[model samples]
Target chain A: MPLRTLLQADDVRRAITRMAHELVEHDPDADRLLLLGIPTRGAVLARRLAAEVARIAGREVPVGVLDVTLYRDDLGTQPTRATGRTDVPADVDGATVVLVDDVLFSGRTVRAALDAVTALGRPAVVRLAVLVDRGHRELPIRPDSVGRNLPSAKSERVRVLLTETDGRDEVTIE
Target chain B: MSDHLLSTRDLSRDAAVALLDVAEDMADTQRRTVKKLPTLRGTTVVNLFFEDSTRTRISFEAAAKRLSADVITFSAKGSSVSKGESLQDTAQTLQAMGADGIVIRHQASGAAAVLATSGWTRAAVVNAGDGTHEHPTQALLDAFTIRKRRFGAGSRGRDLAGLDVVIVGDVLHSRVARSNVWLLTTLGATVRLVAPPTLLPTHIESWPVEAGTDLDAAIADGPDVVMMLRVQRERMTEAFFPSAREYAALYGLSAARADRLRADALVMHPGPMNRGLEIAGSVADSPRSTVLEQVENGIAVRMAVLYDVLAGERTA
Candidate 1:
């Protein structure tokens, strides 16, 4: 595993700040922006995005988590540990949805998450955000916002760490 | 553990209802006299039974055939299960040959739960009946029957909110009773468990139902539905009560007890009834008795379940 410091913790915050402003500009009215974090690391980013969106828009944005365990197309290969509970406070019907995931790899997780979110309610539009973008996508998926890009092998892992969960914002190789 | 339908608690509230909804789609196949679909067309559905079941196995076979799925019926006396191959090994073998789903019935509880969630994720698992644990599809059918009977054409979009359900007889070892308790409660119906103290499970408090030992007191509450569970001869052997006649005299739905219920209150039983034990033959045959309707509803409800789990309504 290569110790590549592509983006420092501070650099990641600035990127999020820019991304948050871009999202606000994309939807000017932005009355109720909904954020759904994919399980584990994505949840941390979802909450952070919500806070950042609030700082820029002068209002608290509603955020939640989506557990896509049952929706996984290729199940049983990975340890399907339940990370935490998902809470959808606002009805996603006709709302702009920003689905946050930690790292984009095969794009299957995002695919499953999209299906699960759709069952909750019909979102007007769905967009994806990633902390780190790792290539080799099995699906035609492109992230709308990215904190940084990491070049990696399939066997290696790009683990996302944040102060909300791991007490420090960093990306580690495993 | 052997794979079987033990309880509804094994299912989440969402999954249970989704299974019921799916069963509805399967029921539609009956409209065609041919009664077959192409969903499980090439897949094999094996019914491995450890206990005697006429309607349950047949109902499942009917369900599989309706789905155009291959059916293999296994008997305890004839199969390797009797020769002592572990259920895990057998399930893995079924997986190898491509069994899309395994509909199993066993004498042990929690068998279905273990199989469905266990590492063998290739096949969809349906629990037919497992020991004193659950008969899920049966309960779903009962609910479907109740909904259709009570609400009619408009029952499709409605959820049972205030329906009073009284379950009478042996709650001790009846898997049907166990399944109904959870499913009914999850669906927002008020469930009353009426049985002898010795017949109630130790964890009855954990169940979201009104539990009492007196049948008269339970029905006196005026439940919209009165379901008499089959008091198995198996329970008599365990000494849950003194005698069948005595139990019937005190707890059974006689001509007099049937009058105690609301006139519209539907009488039900997961059948093969000990008529003289938990319920009188007269009450079971009464027009209000939905015992037969339950059987008819069983097919539709099961079809709905098979389709729901496979259709990926919740999973998709």
Candidate 2:
């Protein structure tokens, strides 16, 4: 299969900057804002977005990692996955929590993340931010902020590569 | 990652390390206030024991409960096994009740192996301990405890390589010793079995371990870990040693013996200890002892094993 580049390094950077500004604008309370990244590529994207948020809002937001492997619904039917570290930095109660991920596909991951976050503590509100939104949501979930809305077929694979993990910054569909 | 964990002899180095790494994750989850996970929510686990056990049963129960699996415990003393029901009948009855996993501790050796391979039930079989055959989870917990103490946070994806381990006393009827011998050796640790001639198993020369009769000589060598095996009085149909006092004097980890050990050397004991017979009370309570840590790690290791058998694809 041929691979198609959806967003290059510059495009990725520009999109992240825009998303960061949008997050700051939506929730002006920077003190109550928390950014939690899903594992692997999503975690790197989260850190990058945190840096951009600090640059735009002139204040640092707490960032942590939340892995939803254990909360997955298809645990027994499929192979068991290794759990990543879940480091909740601040008190989640009464906070504006943003779950950041690299790609938004079936939304099962986001569903698990919702449960994982709720299990930690009750947040005032929970929103989602994604770098790429490939629309094939199995759950009734939508991203609050999206970098690029790439409509694609079900058979294709969407992969996001970041400089922190893959030594590059791009989004590809193959 | 086998379908059934009957013995550590079937576990490769990679398989053992993978399980340990997963146990590390489980241990991390235990540090949280909300320690329960919904991974095995709808599955049912049965604890079938033809032998009596306190810590092993509770550890397995806690492990299954933490993962949100329903547990049913069956003991031979009060169960239908006392009414002349055979093993097959009991196993089939549990299978009919929709048991997804069975953790069994039996008095007969190879009982778990038979349950796993006899086509009686489709559920995964985990050997709690079968007679003197093996207790894979206990060894895995011991390995986890050792790795955690030695490497701390850097313990993930590592084996017990180059660690010198000395196992003392009652090897003939110790499933813990048998399991640890295979697992520790497979993980690249050199193990020495120290016991009286009668307590050592027959044909010990064929096992992948160094054997000795003198505990003082083994301790003087300054091993990285000194594990004490409990002297099971109930299992002693024949006198394995001359007397309890002589046994304590020679093989017991007294305060003096513990003091002679290197400061960094770890002291380990599988539970239900005869306090003054196999290990001194002071030594068992000292900072060097990992007996409590072993019990704590047992829950995590059993959780990892249950997850490995019931949820994960077989990697063995």
Candidate 3:
């Protein structure tokens, strides 16, 4: 399969900076906001977003990692992989949670993340955030904060590589 | 990636590592206030035991419950099996009742294998313990505990490569010993069996492990893990050793021998311990001991096994 560079490192940085600004603009009280990254790359993205939010708001925003593997509906149908860490640093009750992911495609992952988060505690408001919003959503869910909107065919895979996980920041389509 | 985990031999290096990694995730769940996962919400797991077990049974039950699976425990004591019903009958009945997974512990050597292949049920068969043949889950938990203690947080995706493990006790009647020998060896660990001539199994040379009659010699090798098998007093009909005292003198892990072990070396026991006979109480309760951790790891390991069998994608 041939590889295509959808977003370079500078592009990803710009997108993240803009998304962080958008997040700070929407939430005047950033202390009540919690950024939770879905595992693998999402957790890394959440950390990056938290840093960006801290830079803009001048206050630290709590970041947590939520692994949606256990809440996934396609567990038996797809190949089983090892579950990642689901570490919610604090009680999310009455907190506005921004569920962050690297790429938003089918939206099933976000749905699973919702199920996982709901099981932990009741958040006052749960919003979705994605670095790249690739339009192929199957579930009735949409990202509240999107870094980049990249429309592509459903057959093409959108691979998001972060420096923390993949040792480089780039988005690829193959 | 076979649907059924009948023996340790059935697991490849990658599969075993994957199971351990998954168990680590399960262990992570225990730290949370809400330790339940929505993975197997609608699935039903049946604990079918022909033999009496407290730890293994409870571990499986807790594992299944933690994963949000409905659990039904059926022991042979009050069940139809006590009334002369065959294994096939009981299994078929459980299958008819819509069991998604069956964690079976039987006194027969191949009972679990039979259930997995007999077409009596489509549910995944996890062998908790089967006679003197294998206790796959015990070995898995033991491995998990050992790896966790040795490597800490960096234990993920790692095997027991080059680690020396000494399994001491009744190898003849111990399914724990049998399972650990295969699994530890397969994971690239050097395994040595320390037992008396009578306590050792027949044709033991066929096994891929170093056999020795001296406990002190095995301990002097500075093993990373020392796993002591239980010595059942009830199974000692023909006298495997001269007496309990002599067995304790030679093969038993006394306090003195425990002190001689390397500070980092871990002491392990498959539980329901014969306190004074196989391992001294101090050693069993020592800081180096992984007995309690093994029990805790049992739930996570069994959870991983069930998840792999029931929810994991089938391997081609």
Question: Which candidate has the highest TM-score of all?
Answer: 2
* Candidate number with the higher lDDT (2 or 3): 2
Model 3 Cα displacement at B259 (Å)? 1.2
Would you estimate the TM-scores of all the predictions?
0.62, 0.96, 0.93
Candidate 1: tens digits of C-alpha lDDT, residues B143-219: 88888788875565455679999988888888889888888888889998888888888987778888887878887
Q: State the lDDT at B6 in candidate 1.
A: 42
Off by over 4 Å in 1: A1-174, B1-7, B10-18, B235-237, B311-316
Q: Show where candidate 2 strays beyond 4 Å.
A: B313-316
Candidate 3 lDDT by residue in tens digits, B216-285: 9999989988999889766677877788899999999999999889999999998899999999998999
- DockQ per candidate: 0.02, 0.54, 0.60
> Quick one: best lDDT, which candidate?
2
Best by DockQ: 3
> When only chain A is evaluated, what TM-score does every model earn?
0.90, 0.97, 0.96
Model 1 interface CAPRI class: incorrect
Name the TM-score of candidate 2.
0.96
